[model samples]
Target chain A: MRFISQTSSDGVTEQLFTLPATSGDIPGVLWTPDGATGTRPLILVGHGGGQHKQAPGVVAQAHRLVTECGFAVAAVDAPAHGGRPRSTEHDRLIGEMRGRMQAGGDVAPVLAELHALIAGQSVPEWRAVVTALQELDHVGAGPVGYRGLSLGCALGVPFVAAEPRVRAAVLGLHGAETSAEAAARITVPVEFLVQWDDELVPRATSLALFEALGSTEKTLHANPGRHGAVPEFELDSAVRFFTRHLS
Target chain B: MRFISQTSSDGVTEQLFTLPATSGDIPGVLWTPDGATGTRPLILVGHGGGQHKQAPGVVAQAHRLVTECGFAVAAVDAPAHGGRPRSTEHDRLIGEMRGRMQAGGDVAPVLAELHALIAGQSVPEWRAVVTALQELDHVGAGPVGYRGLSLGCALGVPFVAAEPRVRAAVLGLHGAETSAEAAARITVPVEFLVQWDDELVPRATSLALFEALGSTEKTLHANPGRHGAVPEFELDSAVRFFTRHLS
Candidate 1:
């Protein structure tokens, strides 16, 4: 793990870094309270599809977690997303998905395939990142949480299922088609969100994904809106959820 | 409205009262911060079927809203429940419902019928009670919220829809069979709850009721439990919901 740049604002510090990996150097960012050190609960935030680690929503969430909960937050670029180089296979899958969506054809199968391909690489990268992040003097090994949606949720279902270090998760905006089996393996507490009228993900599939989660303590929060219109109050609710489980 | 008794505990004052109605005196209870003497948001809590105005859950929620949010809270006993006389027709429906449950038969139709019969009287009773309560000094006219579940939800749907004074509501635990039409008429913000494994209400019907709500700002919070096992966290969420809309 290597730190590339650091900045501070609004009492939250943001650090950009790169972690050496088998695939290549994985770009990532971490957020913490400004001028502070020592261990605290850390949250791993996964960005939506076509978004990078520092997307506006991701940064806003990171800042809130750091400032409100005093929690360390981190995000990493997916294999073919952000500053990562896309392989020929990645380009082919992306092209197919875009073509199908533009032509009003079914994109579920292809989307699932794309998520599966990315998850294979991203999952290991995440594991390695957690190992390194926790080793930092300022973010020692502590209970970890995950916040992800859409593409992030597609990848997160499997990651949370396999990763025992993750204590809880807030996930949604995706369907069960590609994540049900993995979802069934997750036992930690989960806070799942569903957009009642999500245009990209069918409502039944989103409900099905919530149903598939094996967590004994999972709660589903469904709001009336399109895929991107999750009300702002939900962000407040998520802060409370992580504080309850991780802090 | 006439006060029957008053008690203060833990910085909250509980007052038992009754409002003169054409049908009979409507028995109710009100809670507010001790020494409160000005207009504030008032939340009318409707008790569950077979439960009274001061049922344990109802009292706990009322206390939270009063002590934490400084809001005035009130609850009235439903007809055929909690100090209210049961008509022969009410007795017949109750008997049929209990018998069906013992025989492992479906009780949806009978329950709906019972709800419809009670709602006809309770809706107007609620309106009258609200008018009379808002006339009090501490509980002067202000934004009003409603919280109810099970039979309370069955009655609340119609009451909230018809009572324009109600600005928001937190309701669930019943299904759509009797409430869908009224739910469609409710345009205020709503926080709807659903017990995922509810033994009394079908899951699909609860989802349908949520879907039928006309409120563009409605949110559904579903947790894994039986009909009566709503998690405690939800009460906290309800407090936040009401605070956001009412205050």
Candidate 2:
């Protein structure tokens, strides 16, 4: 991993970085409080699909973690998304899915394939980044936590399951057998946020994912609305959750 | 709805029945003790994917419900499986899924689509069967329960959710957004069974589905094995669950 540039704003130091991986060059941003002094807990913030590492929500989350919680935050662009060259196959498959759905065709196979394609590459890249971060003396050996929503949950589940560095996570917006299996391996404290009537994700799927967490101390915070409408209070709770567990 | 035939064997009286629906003639069987008289609790058993109403497991469960639990049992073939005429679309999709997987392709979208296709037809058909059964004075309207494993759980989740007659259910071996959503609508008592290392169904998915159940009184029976290796002890417990909740 190599730092590309650094910018300072509102007592937050933001640095752009890139990690060379088999998948490609993974670009990301790391946020730290100005004069953060010694090592502090590192919170990895993940973004939703169609969004990048510095998506407004992700940036806000990083800002909050550094300013309010006094924790460093990091986020990387998922492969085939944000700052990465798009795959022709990925675009073709997505087009095929839309066409098939419109034609009243079965599309589960394609969705599964897409998940596998992205996750197969994304999880490993995240792990490499985590390893690289751990080697930095200033980043500390303190606890690490992850917070991702939707697509982030999809990627974070497996990533956290495989990375021992992640001691706690705030995840939700996606659930499946694969994610559930990954969740079963997560014995860390977890805070799951669910949108009760999420248009894309059924409530049961989210609930089931929450139930699958191996953590003895996991909490489910559900609110009413569509996929993107997770209440701000829930976000606050997640921040507190990370603070309580990681700090 | 019409009864096709009635046969008595092993102290259990089996009546093959059919219900006409938009999908086609829905074939089913109802089992009761040979000497059963008056109205007893009724258990609606659901068979799994690729299996018919009289699959060995389904039959055994019916037999147990009638002979041991002293309750009536009923089940029907899901659309495109068993006695039902297989759809060209379903066949084509299955072939496509197989081909895709063999080619190292993702198949989640296809799986989801296939599930939606069957559940779309199966849930409504089950609801219709429930209505038809309720009209039969001989069937009696005592508390009703459901028993389905694997594919059965997939069908039963939505079936039980929509059919208010189902006061209790034995559901597991499948977890998805559709099942989860349907599970959230269920308020009846439930006893869920899980195969820990189910090759087809992940343990996390099963656990999540169990957690999603809206029933206030729910029991989870987990065993060590694959999808088809549900232990006999769990079956015995399900019979007791029906006896307690329905009888």
Q: Evaluated with lDDT, which candidate comes out highest?
A: 1
Please provide, for model 1 over B110-225, each residue's C-alpha lDDT reduced to its tens digit, 9 standing for 90 to 100: 99899889999999999999999899999999999999999889999999999999999999998888889999999999999999999999999999999999999999999998
Per-candidate Cα lDDT values, in order, are 0.95, 0.80
Error of 1 at A235 (Å): 0.8
Worst 10 residues of 2 chain B by lDDT: B216-225
lDDT of 1 by residue, A1-247 (tens): 9999999999999999999999899999999999778999999999999999999999999999999999999999999999999999999999999999999999999999999999999999999999999999889999999999999999899999999999999999999998999999999999999999999999999999999999999999999999999999899999999999999
The chain B TM-scores of all candidates, as shown, are 0.99, 0.93
Per-residue lDDT tens digits of candidate 2, residues A112-218? 67777898999888878777876666566678999998989988888888889899999888866457888899888777777766877777677788878887666
List of clashing residue pairs for candidate 1: none
For all candidates, state DockQ relative to the true structure. 0.95, 0.02
Q: What proportion of the real contacts between chains A and B does each prediction keep? A: 1.00, 0.00
* C-alpha DockQ for predicted model 1: 0.95
